[model samples]
Target: MVEIKEKGEFRYIDEGEGDVMVLLHGLFGALSNWEGVIKNFSSGHRVIIPMLPIYTMPLKKAGMDGLADFVERFVETMKLDNMILVGNSLGGHVGLIYTLKNESKVSRLVLTGSSGLFENSMGGSFPKRGSYEYIQERVEYTFYKPETATKELVDEVFETTKSIPKCLRIVAIAKSAQRHNMAKDITNIQIPTLLIWGLNDTITPPLVAHEFHRLIPNSKMRFIDKCCHAPMMEHPEKFNRILENWLENEAHKAA
Candidate 1:
């Protein structure tokens, strides 16, 4: 298990040491979501995962902009610069907003199964509270392979939804994502972006990836076969290889 640190108002995992690489997770995302990424990249990169204040944020400030604001504060507090941001699902949406607002700080961006364009999130609704089997079914729907939704992962999401306040926060954020469309603002991105999408992703779908590539100039995309929403988890080796090669090529070009 990754050790989560609490300092001031932040709780996150800080590991390795090199150029900074920040990892952001989506709604219902847990530390385990990025376990493969942390292990593979931590050897040569400083990996930081800030536990997004999804459950704790005041319901009024629980939207996309609010989460980006939190990231800004976290970045400032950490005194980080020239960051390489890797985000998945809802985290990708927040990263996009942050990149647009703070372009200089971000040297590169990686998005997978992002939600800013279009997503099939069951009408942007969470499962019925206290229904374990229903929650399991919903979680399984995210992946092409039903077994990808492990018992632990399902239980984690289950426990999270058990709280009424967290449920409210999740609903508000989902609605905010639906309302805040980035089609107009994404064209403003000025840095190199890498989009790694799951070919079988039910949430964002392949068309969404194509749309992102079409909108963002200087962006490249790679699709992993049979992969669903969370490629990093479903196909960690393939995901890592794509990311590693992309990062290396980008660095060489920068040099």
Candidate 2:
């Protein structure tokens, strides 16, 4: 549904026109993660989703700072402005760090199932690497419905986890995110923010969303019932509606 364009070292999907909206995926995320947002908003917004180098980044630089730095370079290289950053899970953490460092460039922020404040991350219970059943269970844990954890989705995660090197990088990035909390710095965010969370998110959970809403001064919160971590995938329609309404309201507020 979306075409990924590569320029230099960055691989991204750029579609439509008008104000720019950058979509950042989570730790084990793929282009499919933001598929709904791209198709829904590309008509009136320039949607951009960068393929983050989670498993490919150098081991030494495989951390939150590394991901945030990559985003900085991508923004500078693309010359993006008046940006609305939409991030999910770890992506949200990177967005928070990005906005904190370059708040002047970001006009608004949307975070769903983000993991800056707190997360379970299995408490270091690394996925049973070669176990398909284990990986399937973990993937299903992300959604309210078990069927939402489609066979293809489970297979993708299983394949990724099966790799030893990839597992190392994943652990490194996950640990860094866990260690780096955003409590003190989130208060510094001055731009308008939106928190879209799954009411039943297990990893970040609903309390995390409450904490985010409580900490960030200019922010709004919306919860999707019977949804888990990735609402965009499980309930694209509802997710897009909440996002579209917020964006429209933001436009009106600006006008």
Most lDDT-accurate candidate: 2
The number of clashing residue pairs in model 1 is 0
**Which pairs of residues collide in candidate 2?**
none
For model 2, the superposed segments whose C-alpha errors exceed 4 Å read: 122-124
Model 1: per-residue lDDT, tens digit, 1-255? 779998788999998999899999998887789999999999999999999999999899999999999999999999999999999999999999999999999999999999898988743466589999988988998887999999998999899889998899988898898888899999989799999999999899999999999999989999999999999999999999999999999999989
TM-score of each: 0.98, 0.98
List residue ranges in candidate 1 displaced over 4 A: 122-124
lDDT of 2 at 206: 97
Q: What is the alpha-carbon lDDT of model 2 when measured against the actual structure?
A: 0.93
User: Per-model C-alpha lDDT, please?
Assistant: 0.92, 0.93
10-62, model 2: which lDDT tens digit per residue?
99999999889999999889989888888899999999999999999999999
